[model samples]
Target: MAFPLKFTLVTALLLLAACRSDPIQFHTLTPAQVGDHSRTTVGVIQIESISVPPQVDRAQIVIRQGNSGLAILETEWWGATLVDELNSALADQLSNYPAQSGYSVRVDVQRFDSVPGQYALMDVKWRLRSAGESEPARVICRSTLQTPSGPSIDELVLAQQNNIKRLAALISQAAARKQAGCLMPVN
Candidate 1:
């Protein structure tokens, strides 16, 4: 009886372990090295924004398809919904590159009012300046996913989130490079 009980316990433990899934994997990125803590106030900066039309219903990527090279059952992942993920990512990325002198940066739907001499004109526009230039005068930036096949909603969200993050980095870098003294990067 003791032996049977021990075997059952071991089997149950093993089954439980097998049923558990591994954590989703992702790559790590280190923030760039920029020196100093300073403060600069940006007055009424116009955020020229553009959004890549959402491709919500259409599958941007396909996974686990059958041998037809890329054909299989289609599934939608949750994360690829739309703006929420992008906005979060963009905010995170831009947080590091703050406008002069450690001033608090604000972004919103309403156009900011410039106080002539007090506010400096910062045009945040979006344009294909180069292969991957961040929008020049846009506050919020957007891009559409180029899905390979039908991806699960989770996968879509992850992929889109990652893309937004990457774009944020690129845009920040571009802004830092272009605007002489506009934004000061985090040390």
Candidate 2:
């Protein structure tokens, strides 16, 4: 009968609609276009280790909803873990330092806050030491890098990217000079 056929068709359509879900979106911290490589250095920069906060170290990007709330985005994910993303991004950017002093950097992220339509903030404690040196100049510094972002997810990622770029620059400069001790907080 036409009634039975119509009911079956409606059920099939409902099933199809229920099965459709939004595709997962993956993002990365890698720069779209790398900078010039003409800086000629003695050795390459090695990102020794990167440690992010437990709250934001997963594949999904965590956003600070308010003063004390955190929202984990299920559908949006990073290409890799948060630590891996930082290691890759820092290695990529620091490779261009014009300094001859090769060094290794270790970063411990105390707080990685991402807020939609507000800002992306990175509060990290980073250390740099010369490579292959018996007594290397060890420098430890903490920096709070913040960048304004738009409401979109892409904009938030871009903001975080900018923070990474700035951190790379600071590490590059520090390694170049071979600081003897801890420095003040950078901007």
Candidate 3:
């Protein structure tokens, strides 16, 4: 009787342990902290539309394994779809920029890659159109931003946030101009 009772308790304890799992962690691309600066802008500078690659648009955080492989982390997720999170982050940062005039910006991401212990990269083709300007007056430009990362997913996320913030800065600076020139490279 004693042995049977001990066996039942051990089995129950094992089952309980098996039921536990690693908690899922959600992350966002938004600024980690709000700044002291005002959130209002002088003129309208809206991010008209931004498109991300379909491959990376999922809720799970997908990372590069090597040159040709990718890994989707089930326990790591974005707060929302990747595209929505990215747009929100950019909009939040761009809303504080002072524009010479109203401008609408559009970005189409060509590549977005995150590698643990490596780097985060964003290559995008962006266009800025002056408010009330025709399509022919718009100037399209491209920028590729890369940030170094440490060995952890958190570091990769931070690197990607930096990349997005840099992209927003580039957009804000280029939107201030109405010429038909491309954006200058940023170091």
Which candidate tops TM-score?
3
Ranked by lDDT from best down, the candidates are: 3, 2, 1
Give the alpha carbon lDDT tens digit for every residue of 1-187 in model 1: 9999999999999999999875533221222337653423242111233332322222232232232333212332223432333344455555555532221222221111112122211122233232223424333333232222123334433344444444445455544454433332221
Q: Model 1 shows how many backbone clashes?
A: 30
Q: How well does candidate 1 score on lDDT at residue 44?
A: 14
Selected candidate, larger lDDT, 1 vs 2? 2
| lDDT by residue (tens digit), candidate 2, 61-96 | 899997899999999999999888888887877866
Residue 80 local lDDT, model 1: 45
Q: Which stretches of candidate 1 lie over 4 Å from their true place?
A: 1-50, 54-81, 99-152, 178-187
Query: What is candidate 2's CA lDDT for residue 59?
Result: 98
Q: Following a full C-alpha superposition, what root-mean-square deviation does model 2 have from the true structure?
A: 2.4
**Model 2: ten consecutive residues of lowest lDDT:** 178-187
Clashing pairs in model 3, backbone N/Cα/C closer than 3 A:
none
lDDT of 3 by residue, 42-98 (tens): 684778788988888899999998789989899999999898988898887787676
